[model samples]
Target: MRWWLTAAVFWTLLIMAVCWLPMPMFPIGTGGEHPKRFPHLDKAVHAGIFVVFGLLWLRVIPGPRRFLVVVAAGAALAAITECGQNLPIIGRDGELADGLFDVLGVFLAYPLATFLFRRVRDKQPVVSMTRA
Candidate 1:
């Protein structure tokens, strides 16, 4: 499969998963009232998107260029998702933390993807490109 296509699939699936199975509310030991909830499950959604997209990027684009494109796409998607959530029809609120989480996710996932790809490719042939 094409790398970008894989990324597209991953993004779609991740969103669907989050939408379909949202995190259940749990008390954060904040006493009888005004309980704070853990958001790890929510944050995981962003991390998952980044990790999957980064893997797709590593598979598709080679070298430093891969980082640039993948990060750009991830950032753009995060921004768009944040904005989209604000629409009345969406019945969602926008939060800066979500975007921040996405950025962190991309930062972590990209390096991990690169490392895994390299490890997987070790002792194997590297892709050769011909300049026109």
Candidate 2:
């Protein structure tokens, strides 16, 4: 559906803001230390969004090869966001671990999305622009 692509773009833009914006712009405080129970909450958050990101792209693209496209796109996004954060003026620290989590999230998302698609969809599907 058109909504999926819209959601994907919106999510990407949201990630851009969240990753690239200045630190103080955060209303909920930076990613240092907050929830004492989980020290790695930040990494979880990174992975979580990427799972959503991967799933959304899987929805947007059609045909058998979408898995490859979604994975490549997700990894590219992870790297881009990491590099964006690395920009000195952005006031954010870039971590390889965070990017790894992001890619891992994408990997984690693909099979789940594929399974759900098989369960819910039939022969004909409404997919993204490319039929291939």
Candidate 3:
């Protein structure tokens, strides 16, 4: 449990760092144009990160309350990161679409982690001792 929480915290901080880091100036024709080559690639990456975030939290969270807490936290974090990007120091713009994708990722990952966890647990062999 501790390990799970630790990992979640670590990942959250890492994501924050990546989100807040100032962008480096790219050579002409190499920066903004690249994103056009891969439509919605940024949103996909944002979703993928939150998906992992949701799965990590699922490891520590349990019961019916899991969804509420995990989703809320994930959404709050997403909002914060997006808002942070708006700061001039960060040199990034905040996008509502990105935040939406982040929440979407959390929603998608929660069920997946729950299903996988149950499946793995169900398949585990049970050991028993009996008197001979």
Candidate 4:
């Protein structure tokens, strides 16, 4: 199996675990005195996770339409994760801003993936010549 595929799968599972597992989530907690920290730190965390998710998908499936499709799927997953938190069984609260941030992170990966692949694709191997 390709390394990229492995990474993508691993990341997807990690995302599911992180989003679904019942844990004491900080910053997003409701009716609790959260730790004293910078505001909206959780928003940054949410965006950062999906950014890597988008990048991994781009590498796993190398094509325009396919990449877009995978990314759309990622966005859908992001939304679903947020919505899932709203379930009383999940013991977490969902926020519209968090979902927006997650989707924003997914798109953010586009330009980054483009830049990375271009740089790698355009890079030329250096050769040194030693002649007698």
Task: Candidate 4: list runs displaced more than 4 Å.
Answer: 24-36, 124-132
The TM-score measured for candidate 2 stands at: 0.84
- Model 3 global lDDT (CA atoms, 0 to 1): 0.87
Clashes per model (N, Cα, C within 3 A): 0, 0, 0, 0
Candidate RMSDs in order? 7.1, 6.2, 2.7, 4.0
Better-scoring candidate (lDDT), 1 or 4: 4
Q: List the residue pairs that clash in candidate 2.
A: none
Clash pairs detected, candidate 4: none
* TM per prediction: 0.66, 0.84, 0.87, 0.80
In the range 65-103, model 4's lDDT, one tens digit per residue, is 866776688878887888888778778877888888888
For model 3, name the residue pairs that clash.
none
Model 2 ranges off by over 4 Å: 122-132
TM-score of 3: 0.87
Which digits, one per residue and each the tens of the lDDT, describe model 2 over residues 31-115? 7557688799889889999999998988999998998988898889889989888787887888899999999998888888978
> Against the unseen true structure, what C-alpha lDDT does each candidate score?
0.64, 0.87, 0.87, 0.80
List ranges where model 1 is wrong by over 4 Å: 1-4, 7-40, 123-132
lDDT of 1 at 28: 30
Error of 1 at 90 (Å): 0.5
